[model samples]
Target: MTPPHATPVGPDLPMPFTHAGVDQLVSIWLAQLDVIRDLAEELTAEQWAAASPCPGWSAGDVVAHVLALESELHGAPLTDHEPDWAALPHITSDFGRLTERAVDWYRTKGQDVVVAELIEITAWRRDDLAHAWNADSDPNEVVTGPLGLELPRERLIRTRILDTWVHEQDIRTAIGIPGGLRSDAAWVCAGQFAFGLPYVWGKKAAAPIGATLDLTVTGPGVSFERLVQINENGRAEFIERTATPATVSLTLDWPTYAAASAGRLNSDSTGALVANSCRGDDQLAARLMPALAVTP
Candidate 1:
């Protein structure tokens, strides 16, 4: 869901325009994958083993997860293995176990092997995706995406771009090499995640009808201000302007906003609620904070 007014600002940053074709989206996804591959190639063994922001996933594990998904998308068979559920308390859902099977398989291999496998798999995926999709392909054609979700091709590719970029940030955070925040992929991810604010407010937070929320994201990569209003039908939608003051307002930096939107800010190990500033309805803001994470 790309927000109507969310515009990514920076030189050469590609905005996820509503009319963007599959080719443009694929280009963004490929760029994000290149960033991850380059970063992985430079990682030290210690950094590879470092714990990422994803609970129970090391930096290498995160890479393996990405490799696992792309490999599946490229027609590679799933690894026939089941992880020890009791030992993996962080894997609380069926999808977690499904993804963990492949990640855990790679965990037994050495760092060099993991990196090499990622490089190989992603290379294959790049070629496969290029052949599979083109600018004229139907963007609305439903196709299977990660976790077996059926989505339009354009949306699936956009989701891939978002996931890859987020994992890249996870790796960077783990290794203390924070960067790529201003990349083309970062702007895409910013808009993609920010698009879920209405869902976060209406469905997750259950804000009362007619209530309005103002969300301001300060970004070096992509900056935007969103005004979400719950309508008479109990649905939230962005409004251009309103006469009444917002019921609540929250401001966050780009990185912090990304982390929170991806549910990383809820991590017991690295969560930082202090990174955000809230005003107006305190109770409503508190409710909205936990519900901010739109992704599972």
Candidate 2:
């Protein structure tokens, strides 16, 4: 909620955060755990390996990713967090146990830093966004996260919420959890990324050479703005967006939007999402589809 890292318009958009945004994110965060619990109740080892929205990953990989992150949360000492240990062992057994060691490490952050701490790191991580959107800063800049370019903290929280909720749905969908995307978390979780499609797809080339496009959501929620890159880089920025929307609206449900953001959903599968936009002209959204379609 402080000033965003930077801003120069790429597409026609809205402000990134609001108070409701926090609630939406929190809802998704909590819902992720609840749904994962449901998955545990309904699924088995065989089912865990079922394919997920993520192209190469299965339900097991998804679980491994979540559990691995939790393991990190508990302060597991990583020789290198880069290529996560999830990819280490050829067999699943070693993979599971090594990460379990990561989890055990968190239990004792100070007392040997492994078993004695015994703290629930998820709750602690949740606290990072408590006041994220508390500001009404007039001009926000894009900040960097641990990895890529950083979004405003507030927007970042929304994406996190969106990520948790959407992946939860992916797991649920794989295991036959009914009524996916039923909560407020689904709307904000999905919408948060939809609004910022332009920023994430900044480097891609647009299909439409000279066209204006927009990605307005079909349902409710006041508009928030962000920009996109439309034309080739190094040309005048405004002229570029006028040629095409480097940014486009994401209008599908929580599951599809999440999958699309992860780079999994093809355009055919995303229904009613860009219902009003110029399809051929909005290459940014689709170009970004690969990353959003899976968990990277």
Candidate 3:
């Protein structure tokens, strides 16, 4: 259930997508890589070691994770890889283990080396993608993702863009350098996450069959609405519009939504944010809003 809060109020606005499509997403991925690297270039030694919002990972560790994944895609050796994460509780997924190993090894070489490698790998990928991405190619072709899971090429690349942008935010948050909120990366991240609202509402929140809900997410230079309804098949699906008025609706700025979705906003904070933005049927909104977060 979405926790009760005291502050769920906000203004209504329009949402627009300026960039989308497989090739466009691949381009965004490359652009975000540069964004991360450029941000890393300004980090001081102390800043690089500062803990990011990601539990137990420093800003440098986050950067290393990116580098590690790219290197894997490029088939670069991880070198003398040793598994020392049995003691790390968060290193549960295969992908987590891989990132940890890469981060641990990269830390030994120091921040400068890691930053340089980031720039190099990003540059390589940018050039490679320029010639490799063909809009006519199959988007559903299976490809190995950074986490070792096989996903369709289109899905994998979109995940990569989202991950890269999120980490860029992580680095910025850690070092107090936040400024990517209006970029293509930010738009794509929010848009992609918004696509999962149905699963979160229907399955996680257990909304009644045939129930309808509306959402209005406002961010810097962005505002969008989504409709989620349980179909006759008893599945929650994102529909264009409902014949009847929505059962509930929520309106909030993007930062609060992003923080909550990323699990950065705790239950109390989330409740306050929701209370400030939610509009009708407070009980129903509370139950559905918290369930909107489906990211891993």
Candidate 4:
């Protein structure tokens, strides 16, 4: 059940990647954290228990997940905790189980406690990030991210912004207070997800070579038109213009685009498919839609 109020437009497509400095990205990440903190602080006990879009996670659990990650980033020591996997069937991957350990630890505490921890941890993270990097810093400088992955400094922060914004939306949707769909963080997150469409079409969906798919995202904030063609090398790439007609064309709103790209539309409960208008080759569109989720 996608909320009726969730249909807000995002910023234009192809975000200013080259110009987005580390400081700016951190600011966006901080803004997302502020939104999440506010949402968590106002939640009632019953609302905290509400089921979120994330499998087996309550609204409070989502906050806890955010808090846990930030706490780790803030240099908090990891607790010796392991969830009983047999009792948690919703966890289907090693990564899920790993993240669940921290989330489950907070489940033993009160909701207010979780909110307080989130506030404290996020505040600390904000201060640390302010001093850690700056606009003039090398964006390509390698930094460690979660799971021991080494990523460029800018990419690591952008990933945090995307994750924080998405989780904020999860909390908002769970408690029926949908918003933050048009924030700066929202646009960044949307663009990051949209950037993955090439991989989805090329490798995941396996669109036929020489076929072109036109994707138009209608947004008041995060809107963009893209034409992706499978080139002779059997690779999908975005092109500025094309003379050949598209084999498939898909139009969707920003919210629907984000939801689908985030893998939230895979469940029938989201009702997100109803919002997408597809044309041209039906078979190709079918293949593409299922492969749209580029996030793990």
What's each prediction's TM-score?
0.91, 0.52, 0.84, 0.91
**Tens digit per residue, CA lDDT, model 1, 1-296:** 32333453421232355456788888889878888888889999899999998999999999988888888888788788877778999988877788889999988887899789878877887898788898888999999987667988888988898899999999999999888877767777777876787888999888999989887777756576778899999999877655778899887888888888888875442223523488788778778887888666
RMSD of each: 3.9, 9.2, 6.0, 4.3
lDDT of 3 by residue, 123-201 (tens): 8887777777766657889977665689898888878877888888788889987677767777677767777788877
Model 1 weakest 10-residue run by lDDT: 5-14
For model 2, how does the per-residue alpha-carbon lDDT over 37-137 read when each residue is reduced to its tens digit? 45544556666657776544556555544544544433454533233345445335544454444333332232222211212444544554344433353
lDDT against the true structure, per candidate, is: 0.80, 0.45, 0.74, 0.79
Name the better of 2 and 3 by lDDT.
3
User: How would you order the candidates by lDDT, starting with the best?
Assistant: 1, 4, 3, 2
**Candidate 2 deviant stretches above 4 angstroms:** 1-17, 20-28, 79-156, 200-210, 216-254, 266-295
Where in model 1 is the C-alpha error above 4 Å? Answer: 1-16, 267-276
Regarding TM-score, does 1 or 3 come out ahead?
1
Where's the lowest-lDDT run of ten residues in candidate 2?
110-119
lDDT of 4 by residue, 228-277 (tens): 88889999888765667788888887777777787766555233453348
